[model samples]
Target chain A: MIWQFDLFILVLLVITALVALKVRDLLSAAMIFSIYSLLMCLLWAEMGAVDVAFTEAAVGAGLSTVFLIATILRTTRRTTD
Target chain B: MSDVLTFIISRFNYWIYIVLMMIGLYAMIAKRNYVKKFIGMSIFQTAIILFYVSTGVKSGATIPILEHGHDIGHAAAAINPDHYANPLPHVLMLTAIVVGVATLGVALAVVQKVHDQYETIEEPEILFKLGQE
Candidate 1:
């Protein structure tokens, strides 16, 4: 039963990765990447690594996303492709 | 049957962590944009932290604090006196978190400079402009 949740997270991670790769806009890609990080944090928590999950949540989901958005703001939002 | 299934299921998290990590690394290396690279870097760092924390788990173990009135020396030999995980990983994670933040800060500052000088962040375009000059 627990494996079901793990499998779900895996699927979500794959979908997010695909979106990050296929998205033409840089900002949207960064947003999807942030979602990927958040899903990873949940996976960590499920693995009994609460401390790691906490760090991932705080740094990956919070700080890193903000940093990416700030970078996007400073640069062009469009992709040539 | 259920017990065996449960045993296999327990290890599923590790597999997912590894998969996500590989994807993140691949993106970091293949992506051209500076910001995308930084996002990939953070994802890669996060995956490693997840791997480390997962390794610290011991089945049926409790947090690593001694109970009130418990003797430290005597409790050391007890079979299940709140079998705490290795705190080393937690400590290491704190350091990793700090380092990750530092790396992001430096990377962002560099990106700012790159934007200021090039007036663009796209890797190929920047290279083209540099070649033109």
Candidate 2:
């Protein structure tokens, strides 16, 4: 595994996670969270877990974002805290 | 100093996972919104899956697939197990990814129901309303 590439994705993952949690707009948070998942997918693929990466790309980044957005739309767009 | 730097650099993947797990744990505990809490839970699950998959990685080895298994003549060929990435953790994490999504779906549905009944998805607000009743 290339340590440099792994480090790059890992740093991005951490930043996305923080942004997802910090964003007040729930929709934005969901999008950023999906970004986090994608970075995670990249990390797994880099580490040679192709199956896991595909599953994460499909489920974690794809379906989970949709789920979060639908729930956000039905409930509330902005968080209180 | 160089030895210490190399040591940290070599195992940096594990360190990042630990940091991510902490972020998720903090969100799960400190976040007020139910949806955010569930997001935290998802992050936490992903961190765990990351740790497991990273553990399965072997440097210079390809993915866990037989290169020449399709060749009937090579059926009896000796293969080095160390030449492929470990499939056990990958398989286990596949189940984990499915379970995480299922849990997120159910949890979000419950959150929506709570918002419908209480007009708020924040935990303190819901509890406040409950305390009044």
Candidate 3:
């Protein structure tokens, strides 16, 4: 019953998440994190949890990333880790 | 062989979720930047939400919304609960999502204030500054 499309989405999700965590530039990390969030939204939608997907798209892709980038704007963008 | 394939396919989503959870856990525990830890915490929350939502899904069930034409006059007329996904988890997670946003907002504000005072967002540097004062 596993859909090929869902499997593809999961692979991309994992890759984006890892890159988001590993990237040096805070801006790049924030952008990649949005990608991760959107993929998660899609997954939840496919799973019949439309409410969760909608919330994730709004909070994760929209508000959370914007706030993270705003914080970066206020502070330095470089990270030692 | 097909039996094993079916079993793995049926259960692989949970496995993937577990791997994602571990990644977030490791990042939260080992990342040096305060923002990174915040990201990890959010990821961890997402994983838990996903797990709970998946639990409410019944195989072959549709979305929880009731059909418009269905009547409630009798036991047979009622919309069978098993025909739709369970909605309790979805309702609870609604509150969780709002709380998560508030948490992220508060966490980022704390990070901003710490950066303003110490001029650094790295944990080690913040600790160093705190130790000096």
Q: Pick the candidate with the highest DockQ.
A: 2
Stretches of candidate 1 off by over 4 Å are B1-15, B62-83
Per-residue lDDT of A43 in model 3: 83
> Cα lDDT for residue B104, model 3?
91
Q: Candidate 1 vs candidate 3: which has greater TM-score?
A: 3
What TM-score does candidate 2 get on C-alpha atoms? 0.95
Q: Which residue pairs come into collision in candidate 1?
A: none
Model 1's TM-score against the true structure: 0.78
DockQ of candidate 3 compared with the true complex: 0.69
TM-scores, all candidates, are: 0.78, 0.95, 0.90
User: Which should have the higher lDDT, number 2 or number 3?
Assistant: 2
Instruction: Write candidate 3's Cα lDDT for B1-133 as tens digits.
Output: 9999899878877888887888899899999999899888888888888888878888788877877655555645666887888888988887888898899999999999998889999999888888999
lDDT value, residue A79 of candidate 1: 71
State each model's CA lDDT, in order. Answer: 0.75, 0.92, 0.86
- Model 2, range B33-115, lDDT digits (tens) per residue? 99899999999999999999988988899998888788768664678888999999999999999999999999999999999
Ranked candidates (TM-score, high to low): 2, 3, 1
True contacts kept of 2: 0.79
User: Given candidate 3, what's the lDDT at residue B130?
Assistant: 88
- Tell me the spans in candidate 3 whose CA falls farther than 4 Å from its real position: B1-9, B69-78
